[model samples]
Target: MPVHRQPGPTAGATSQLWPSGGRHLWPSGESSEVQSHARGHLVYAANGVLAVHTERGTSIVPANRVAWTPAGFTHQHRAHGDTDMRIVFLAPSLARLVPDRPVVFLASGLVREVLLALTGPRSYDPAVPDYSRPARSRLLRVLVEELSEAPEQPLHLPEPQDDRLRAIARLLHETPADSSTLAELGKAVGAGSRTLSRLFHDELGMTFYEWRTQLRVHHALVLLAEGHDTTRTATACGWANPSSFIAAFTDIIGTTPGRYRSGRVVQDQIVVAQDQEQGSDRP
Candidate 1:
C-alpha cells in the first residue's frame, strides 16, 4: 500500500501489532503533523534519517539508531532523504522497561537483525505454513533485551523555554554555521553570558557550547543524509575545519559522516534490488 504522509493526532505514525507494527516508506522531505500515541513505540529507520519533534525537544534517528517515543508525548516526524521508516508498537508491559522520555538508542548488530527479521520476508514466508506464534514472541523478547543493552545516544537537541534563550536558539537554528559565542549572542538578546548560562544549566542541563555542538551535529546529520560531502557539510554546519567536524560528529553520532552516507547508499541499493525482485514476482 502506498503510504501518504499523514495528518491528525496520531497522524500516519500509527501503532500496529508486534509482528508488523506500522511501517512507512517516506520520500525525502515528508513530514507528519503534530500527533501523540496512546502506546509507547519504537521507530527504526531501515535506510534513512528520521527527526522526531516534540514539546520537550527533537530526537534524530539515523539508520544506525532506533528511537523510543514514550506514550503521550505530543510529537511529529519528518524524513530526510528517501526514508524507509519502520515502527514497533510496545504494550505497557514492555514500554515500562525503557525511558519515559523520547530517547534515541544505538542499534547494535543484533538489534538490527532482529528488527529486520521480525518485519522482513522471513515473517511472511509461506513455507512456515502457520507462522509459529511462540517464535515471533521470542524474537520480540530478544529485540527488547538487545535494545536495553545498547546505550541511549545523545541525538536529542533540548528545546529551551526561556524567551531569551529561545531567541538565541532561533538565530542559531536559522544559521547553525553562525560562529557567535554565548556572550556575543547575548548581546543581541540584551543579556549577559552568565545569565544565559544560568538558564541553560537550570533548565536544559548543559553549557552553552555543549548545546550548540549538539545542535550542529544534528544539522550535520540532516545534511550528510541529504548527500552533502564532508568538507561541505562541515562548512555548512559551522565547523571551521573538517577534522573538527568529523571529531564532533563521531563523538556524538558514533560514526564518521562519510561512513554514515556510504552505509545509507548501500541500504538504498538493497531496497532497489528488493523492489525489482518483488516486481518480477508479481503476476
Candidate 2:
C-alpha cells in the first residue's frame, strides 16, 4: 500500500546536485507502512501536516515544522490533508547533527524555501539558469544549519515503557472524545486513579490533564488540516464548546484553529509559533 511518487531516478541520473530521496504527494488519509531508509532524512510538508511514527513515539509535523528521522530507524508516515511531502536525505556525518531520536523542529521561511528548491519538480528550470552542483551543496548545508540552530518543539507524545501506561494511552487514543476522568479510566484498566496519575507523570513527564490536553489538541490539528470547520472539530475533539477549544488551541498552537483550517501559515510568520502537535495511533 506504499506509494512512491516521482520514483527514484535511475542510477547516474544527472549527478544529483544534492542528497534528495525524491518527492511524493499523498492525499488525505493515506499512509505508508513501517519502513527504514539507509540514510537519515528530513520529511517536510509544503502545504499540510505529516504524522511521523517511530518506535519512540509520533512526531507531528505541520507546515511550520519539519520531522527528522535518523538512519536505519523504522518509521511510517501519514498525511492529514492534501499533503505535498518532500524529502532530503543525509549522509552519516550530516545525520549526526540530528539526534537519533525523532524530533520536530520549527521550519523557518529560508529552510522551507531551501527544501522546496532542492526537491521541487521544476528545480532545474532552464530559464532561472541551472543550479550548479556547488550551489546546491551550499543550499543543502544551509538547510542543515538552520535545523541545527532551530529549537526542538515538544510536539512528540512519547510512548511509555510500562504496560499500565499503555492501557491509558490506548483508551484515549482509541477515542479521543472520551472524557473519562482519570479515576473512571482507572476503573476500566484495573488501576486506581492515584496509580494512573503517578504513572502518567513518571512515564510521560506530564500530568494526566496535560497529556489529555495535548492529545485533544493533536486531534484538533488533524481535523483542521483535513479542512473541517472549528465547530465540528471542537465537538469531535471533546471540547465543551468552540470558544473554549479556540482558547486552548491558540494557547498551545500559537494561532486560532480557524486560521489553521484556512491553511495560512505562509512565509510571513513561519517561525512565529511555538511547539505544536497532531497525529493518531494505527497499527
Candidate 3:
C-alpha cells in the first residue's frame, strides 16, 4: 500500500517499505495523516525539512538532526520541501537505549552514516551479502551511544497545556507575523501580562518572548523549505529585517536561510551516493 498519496502534479513522491523501516519522498506542503506505531522509530530528512507533530509538540528535522518518536505516540509528519525522508524502526531491546519521550538529537557525521546505512538496501536485503543481524545490532549500538553523548537539541517546541497559554499560543501560531507584545496579547486572551508570562515559564519552560521567537523560527523554516526567499521569509516570520532574521535563524539552526536552502540538497545527495557506494561494496 502507498504510505501517502502523491502530493500533486507539480511535486513527485514515492514510498518504499522494508521489514525494518521505509523511505518517503514528499513535496513541500505534503502531510501524513495522524498515525502511531507499535515500535519506536527514528526519522531523518536527508534533503529538505520535516516537522514531526505529536501531542507533546513539534520537532524539526533538518539534514543534521534526527527526530525520535517513542512507540504508541500519536503523530503526523509534514514535509517542508522536496524531502527524502528515511525511517528506521528499532527492536524493543534497542529502543530501550533511547529516551521514553519524543526528542531531537544533533546527528554527528557517524550517526548520519549509520542512519543511511541502516536504511539502505543492504540492511533491507535478507541475503548472504547483506548485513548480518549481529552487524546491524552493533551499528545500532554505536548510533545510540553517539546520540547519548550529544545533548538534546532545543528543536522541539513543547505544547502548552494551560488554557490561557493555549489560547495565546493559538493566536501566535495562526499568525506568526503578528508583532503583538505580551501585554497586548494578554489583553486579547483575557489575562494579565505577568500571569501569562508565569504560565509560559511554568508550562513551557520559557518566557513569552522566548517561546514566541522559537515559534517564529519554526515558521521561518517551513517557509524557507517551501522555496520562499530569505527576505520574504523574514518578513513573513515577523522579522523586521533580513539581517535580524539571518542572525536568529543562524543562531538556532546554525546556518543562514540562504545557505540552508542552497546547500542541503547537494549535501543530502552526496550522502545518499556515499551510502549506495558503501552498500554496493559491502561483502
Candidate 4:
C-alpha cells in the first residue's frame, strides 16, 4: 500500500524573498512523492532516512547527511516505514553554494543549527533582520565547506561487470531476497557454480554470496526509505527472518538495518532502494 501525505509549507515564507525553499518533518511511517518545478533544493536528513531518485541515480540520505538536488529534477521523499525523518529544503541560490552533484555532508554543530532555523516557523519572517543575515551567510559558508570536504569513502556499492555476471547481477538486483543458490544462479546464467563464483569475485571484488548479500542490503534500504517496516523489508529482501537480516545488516553496515534506514547510523545510508513494484510480484 502506498502511503501518501501533503507537501509541507515552503520554508519561511521568506522563501519567496529568495528563490524557493521548504522544510518538513516526515514522521516514522510517513511519505510524500514530489515532482520538482523550477526550484532546486538541498535536503538535510536530521533523524531519519531520506531517499532521492532522479535521472542521475538513486541516493539514500541518512541522519546528519545532506543531499543536493539541482533545479528541475524530479524526485520523491519519504521516511523509512518504521523510522521518522526531518528534512530542510533550500533554494537553488543557497544550494549552488554547496555541491553541483548529489553528495552527503557531515553535519557540523553550526550546520545543524542552520537547518533547524530554516525549518523553524520564525524563518518565514520577511523583515530583513540584521541578526538573521549573518546567520544565513554563515550557514551558506558551512554548506560550501562541507561540500568541498565530502568524504572519499562513500557508502555505495558498484555494479558488476561481465555479461554473464551482469545478467546474474541484474537478477539479484531485481530480487535481492531471492534465495537461489550459486548452482541455481549459474544454471540460470548457463555457467557452473565454480565459474560463477570466480567471475563474481574477479569482477565485483566479492564472492557470489557476498555480492548477493550486499545487493540484498542495498535493496532493503530502498524499502525502508519507502516507509516499509523492518519485517516487511526483511521479507522483501529475502532474509529468512528479521533477526538474520538484522545480524547481516549490522555486520556489513556497522549498524542495524533499522538504524541505518532511519538515518540514526553514523554513516551515509549506503543501502539503496531498488525499483519496487517490478519485483514484488516475483515468486
lDDT: worst 10-residue window of model 3: 1-10
Model 3 Cα lDDT, one tens digit per residue, 166-246? 888899899999999999998888999989888888888888888888899899888888889999999999999999999
Q: What is the lDDT of candidate 2?
A: 0.77
Q: Tell me, by TM-score, which candidate is best.
A: 3
Off by over 4 Å in 4: 1-20, 26-34, 37-40, 82-99, 106-110, 125-131, 152-174, 179-215, 219-248, 251-254, 257-283
Q: List the residue pairs that clash in candidate 2.
A: none
Q: Write the per-residue lDDT of candidate 2 for residues 102-220, one digit (tens) a residue.
A: 88887877888898887765453334554667887798889888899988876777877778778888888888889989999888888899988888888888899888888888888
Instruction: Give candidate 3's error at residue 248 in angstroms.
Output: 0.8
Model with the higher lDDT, candidate 1 or 4: 1
Clashes of each: 0, 0, 0, 8
Write down the RMSD of candidate 4 (Cα, Å). 11.5
Q: Select the stronger candidate by lDDT from 3 and 4.
A: 3
Compose the digit string of candidate 4's lDDT tens values, residues 159-220.
Answer: 55577887887787777778989999889989999888888777656787776776687677
lDDT of each: 0.79, 0.77, 0.83, 0.60
Candidate 4 minimal-lDDT segment of 10 residues? 11-20
Mind sharing the TM-score for model 1?
A: 0.83
Candidate 3 vs. true structure, TM-score: 0.86
